[model samples]
Target chain A: MSKVSFSEEASVEVVTESFADTPDPRLKHILTSLVEHLHAFVKDIEPTEAEWEQAIGFLTATGHLCDDTRQEFVLLSDVLGVSMLVDAINNRKSVAATDTTVLGPFHMVESPPRDLGANISLDGNGEPCVFAGQVRSSDGTPLAGARVDVWQANGAGYYDVQQPDVQPERNLRGLFETDERGRFWLRTVVPRYYPIPDDGPVGRLLTATKRHPNRPAHIHVIAEAPGHASLTTHVFVEGSPYLDSDTVFGVKESLIRPVTNVDDPARAEHYGIANPFRLIEFDIILDPVRP
Target chain B: MSKVSFSEEASVEVVTESFADTPDPRLKHILTSLVEHLHAFVKDIEPTEAEWEQAIGFLTATGHLCDDTRQEFVLLSDVLGVSMLVDAINNRKSVAATDTTVLGPFHMVESPPRDLGANISLDGNGEPCVFAGQVRSSDGTPLAGARVDVWQANGAGYYDVQQPDVQPERNLRGLFETDERGRFWLRTVVPRYYPIPDDGPVGRLLTATKRHPNRPAHIHVIAEAPGHASLTTHVFVEGSPYLDSDTVFGVKESLIRPVTNVDDPARAEHYGIANPFRLIEFDIILDPVRP
Candidate 1:
């Protein structure tokens, strides 16, 4: 006495059963759960034909906006909070490990390796600042020889990819290797808080929902030390707007750091920067490799 | 105090609350429920970064495949049974009224008006048959002057739109007014079951799930009479393949009708067809308009 007939009551079972013969069990589980939740959503919303059509149109427009440079679906997912959730789910960390945020869509090109004292503000877009960071193990031991990959927007809040014709090649992007003291230092411009690319359908979605399209100013960091877990996170400026309400929900309290006025002439000279320059110092803690 | 954080536990509330100031209450409600369900699905699946990217890629591909001629998203919805569920939810019928089904994506063009008893098989590609039907109210009273719009795939299982160059415009499609006796008749070929347009992402999904893309043979009908609720449904061919397992879940026991031989030469003369021809007879019942 099997119920093969598809009815509203039997919808979840019927669809899930259709995927029962899937060769990949993980895919099967994912799809089965997807259908279950999707049906629940449809039944709960009970959208009319017009509303359904509107949704389809919205998705199609979102899709049409995607290309090599702009990935609207990822932006859609980012705005919906799914992207951050996926980041959190994938990068579960130990108590002392740096909190991982979304890798974001801008890290398409690899960061060119540079020396510790090299200046990354190639276009000289914003006020010069020193970014000094130390990578350490969760148990408070310094992690020497750690590779640090960093990328960020310029003072105008546009990644290099967004304005290739205007910005210098690989502006505000560099990969640095930490020293014996687990320290890495680089000179770059302060990244300004800017709106996400808001000309697309996802941008229109934000407008329609009364949501802003801005992410707080921050530097993207990816720290990978040998025999330690890799991390992808951001160090937010102390008083950036939208810090409390990141459009992508990537902000965390521990990740915010202040920009200090370091007036030491010797240290500034050693770093090849002017005295009284603005500096952002952050310490990154990484966990041991997961079993 | 309210929680403004965006942890996994606080994700649904945080995202939904962002839409709190939406001008439309229905939009707010739908978005809140959507966020809730979507987050639940993501948590349940706990997909990895690569898997999430794969999902984003899949949706993007599906959206990219949509155009004026082909709507891959609609096909995705059809294969998932959301289309059928939406139909059932929208068209709750009286006990005597015919059950409703998906309007389907093929009815993009209007059915050209034709005289009753006209032959609708423009290409004469399949075995000739006469389709005779009566339109009646749910109380069993014949409803004269009813409008009947009908469309179907050809014997080769292709709609005119799917083969625009080969088939005539409005082939296998007609809109007719019932006679004084509430009788409508037309000559057409028997529809054949066919796979849904399966070259796109949705089709690839079917292949991954080990499910066929075929829908059973059926003719789409939309019946409307003055002061009555218009209905869209189908009369399915009896014993058709995939009837019990329609890719779109559109089959119902009450909709099935068998093709039978009509040996009477007199009736054939009246229908302008050969004697002892095959015939399919169906009757439609409509409900009074809902308040």
Candidate 2:
């Protein structure tokens, strides 16, 4: 009995009922709840008509802005701390292992391979230091030949991804294997802390929310061995200004460490650096994930 | 000592005694766990460099798309089924009441007020029908003076918001208060099913995923009374096409009903309609929210 001739607002009950055949019970359940909450949220907020149009326009632009290189939305999530929240609820690392942080939006490519003793810094201008670390199981047994992937921003806190033309592709990024004793050592510059890209809608959100976009100075590392839960972590500089307020909420106390300057001639000779250089040790422990 | 000056291809261990002074134990715990899972997910996904960049760009655009009225990202979440999942986990409705669905982005502004028996249609060329509904507590107690806000698409399957220049402001939308007997009535046309806006990144995602953007034809309704939880729901026409494939995933069986034509002169006299007219009824029951 279809009546298609008069003009008036139709009934909601009839309209809602007509879509009974949608597949996916999960989808149905989710959509129904979303409608309820979203409607409630709108009623609660009660924005003006103009404001509503502005929101729509903003979303339209957001869709238009997407492309192969930019991910403004994820950055927004990172800056707003939602990403961190999701990660926190999911990771739940055991005690004793070093904590982890945000992988950031820049780790988009494969790192170059290198030997255990090799240096990853292509630019020689920054301060030199030797970083030695052991990859061990949660019970302190070292795992030899563990693969360690590392990347960092330059002294100015810019990654190669951020400056593809200026910085050589994969600069300061490398993949290396651990030594027989489950130890790895390499030389690199002290990375400078940097702010996230502030050139998109996420930047606008940051400005609107009065939140900073800087992450503390840190080096990102991912350690892995077969059967072990891969550890994605960072080593934060002890005094970095943004440590307490990493825009992505990535900084953790267990991941922060101080870089000690050592003038020991023997240690300097062993690593082939001049006397009085920076030294820091980062030990990583990984739990066994069910195979 | 800092002894490593790595070349572009060399790998180095950067000692990090960082994160020594980070406060906020909760923050530290969260950041650490997030780092672990995020890195793991990335490694697991193993997206190509180009794919990774594209994802980043998609997220960036999603962020840019947010504003006051439209939430493209939320829509994205809806299409991806994340929004519904969140809704289901949070809103575990019982079997008696009408189910929920995704609240579309169009409900941005407050609806215009109308008398209980007033028509909300500005266009007189569409379907003619009378909609009657009752409001009650979840236990079926009548709720006198309850409010019912309603809106719908026009004969062309377009909302007033979608055709501002053609449709009068607030066309097909109305807010009505229930009578002393907790009953409300209105006159209007049955709206046809239509497609969601498909000119954005979310549209692109749908296209790439080979999904249609069509939503089942339906009317939107929200009923509220003091001391009772507000109910936002929709009414689907029984036989409307696209009921099985609403792009926004908003369909509940309890919401579907047929509007049958009636030739009773007495009812036509009461509603001031012609002898042959259409009618549909829906009784909404809302639970009480604890203070």
DockQ of each: 0.63, 0.07
Residue ranges of candidate 1 with Cα displaced over 4 Å: A1-3, B1-3
The whole-model lDDT of each prediction reads 0.90, 0.68
For candidate 2, the C-alpha RMSD (Å) to the true structure equals 10.9
Q: Comparing to the true complex, what docking class would candidate 2 get?
A: incorrect
Worst 10 residues of 1 chain A by lDDT: A1-10
Best by DockQ: 1
What is the per-residue lDDT of model 2 for residues A7-28, given as tens digits with 9 covering 90 to 100? 0112222222322344655434
> Judged by TM-score, which candidate is best?
1
Q: After superposition, how far is residue B232 of candidate 1 from its true place, in Å?
A: 1.1
Report the lDDT tens digits of candidate 2 across residue range B1-291: 122221111111111112223364433343344333343343344344344446656656665656664567767756644344333433455555555554567787689999877888888647888888888887778889889989889889888877778988888899999998899989888878987767777787666545788878788888889997666678988888866656665665667888898989998887767889988778888777767
